[model samples]
Target: MKNIQRLEMETKGIALSQQELIIYLQENGLQPHEEYNAQSPSAKKAIYQTALSTLESVANNPEMMRNVKMDDMTVSEFHENLTDRIDQLEKKIRGMRTDANQSDFFMLFN
Candidate 1:
């Protein structure tokens, strides 16, 4: 649906068709809320989750991360970049969770 495309745009370099998104959600045991907008923190979390998963797929594979030069980039550098992106996404997701789950705590002193 429109929401999926919006999510794709929000996610840098990510492009997943509706079917692909559904499959990913199913495969990863992820289910976005019934009414999630592209700008919602939850939606951003889901997008980051998807992007993280995509990167981890290649990052986890030594062969995929093997000697593959892109102009001036080295294989080690590429792997490091992917690792950094995955780490960043993880941190973002954690922050989103913290924000979304915030609650008030009160204490009284007599």
Candidate 2:
């Protein structure tokens, strides 16, 4: 078995098979290693690879991005959005209450 220990070690000890690496690349909108003419052993190439991997990890984590984006919002903006959602929910609750009251009245009459 061709264990990719070097690649795994480079990626903070996250061991991934060749197939898994290919899938990861695809999921992260990255081209395969074969597509890049990256055969040379250069420091620049290594740095680029590391940055790209970091980007992939960040992109794949939706919750992290959501938190980061939420953090970027101003307090006022966050409050406004929350208020809008709450208003909508309150409207729904009011409508449901009216509906339930009508059903109860109809049941008592029947």
Candidate 3:
């Protein structure tokens, strides 16, 4: 048996997103099941299962294991990425609100 640490919804103050899982699966060379949409329930399940299998390999699994030489994401880098994503989301929300307000204003004229 292999010791596989299951990833939680939020790990170390960072919320895990579906995109991250898909990336991990791809990095590990697992071909995600394509029958369903990328965000579909069946696709997610298939990706998760493949990842779990890769993590289970006891021997030196270069594909699944993190390579220090290639992987360079530090805490600071993660924080910066998170901040950028939040900023983008905030901008999008603001745009949506402005659009909604404009729509309402136009409705009043008609």
Candidate 4:
């Protein structure tokens, strides 16, 4: 019973990590290319396997594990930090778009 409970908890953590990765990719417009998506099941599996291997390698690295342990922040604090970074990036992008439009308008008048 204890083993089952531990396995269930680990499975939940992996699912959450995968979901977060998917969300991050989508937010960054990093969807799989159309050709890859249209490929057969084997091809898709290969892609996913590569991603999983990469993640596992990083997670198992001593330096990376050390960094994770050194972070004293709570989960909520981590989320808040990421939120602020996203907000700043969005604002910067918006400002760039506005500046580009203004430049185009001035060029048209000139």
Task: Report the Cα lDDT for residue 66, model 2.
Answer: 53
Estimate the lDDT of model 2. Answer: 0.43
Please give the lDDT score for candidate 1. Answer: 0.61
lDDT of 1 by residue, 1-110 (tens): 44445445544443345676655554544553344455566655666677667677667677756645578889888888878888888888766742355555434775
Q: Weakest 10 consecutive residues, lDDT, candidate 1? A: 27-36
lDDT of each: 0.61, 0.43, 0.39, 0.39
- 110: Cα error in model 4, Å: 17
lDDT: worst 10-residue window of model 4 = 1-10
Task: Give TM per candidate.
Answer: 0.61, 0.28, 0.29, 0.30
Off by over 4 Å in 4: 1-70, 97-110
All predictions: root-mean-square deviation over Cα? 5.2, 20.9, 14.2, 15.0
lDDT of 4 by residue, 1-110 (tens): 22222222322323335544444334433343323432344333333333443345444454543444325775455445444544554454444422124443445464
Model 2 ranges off by over 4 Å? 1-41, 70-110
* Cα deviation of 30, candidate 3, in Å: 32
What TM-score does candidate 4 get on C-alpha atoms?
0.30
Candidate 3, residue 102: the lDDT equals 39
Q: Tens digits of per-residue lDDT for model 3 on 1-110?
A: 11112323212233335566555556644443333334344334433444443333311343322332225675455445545544554454334432124343445465
When 3 and 4 are scored with TM-score, the better candidate is 4
Tens-digit lDDT track for model 2 on 1-110? 11123334434423345676665544434445533323333322332344345445544555544554454685456445544544554454334432124444445464
> Looking at candidate 2, what is the lDDT of residue 35?
32
Clashing pairs in 3: none
Using lDDT as the yardstick, the better of models 2 and 4 is 2
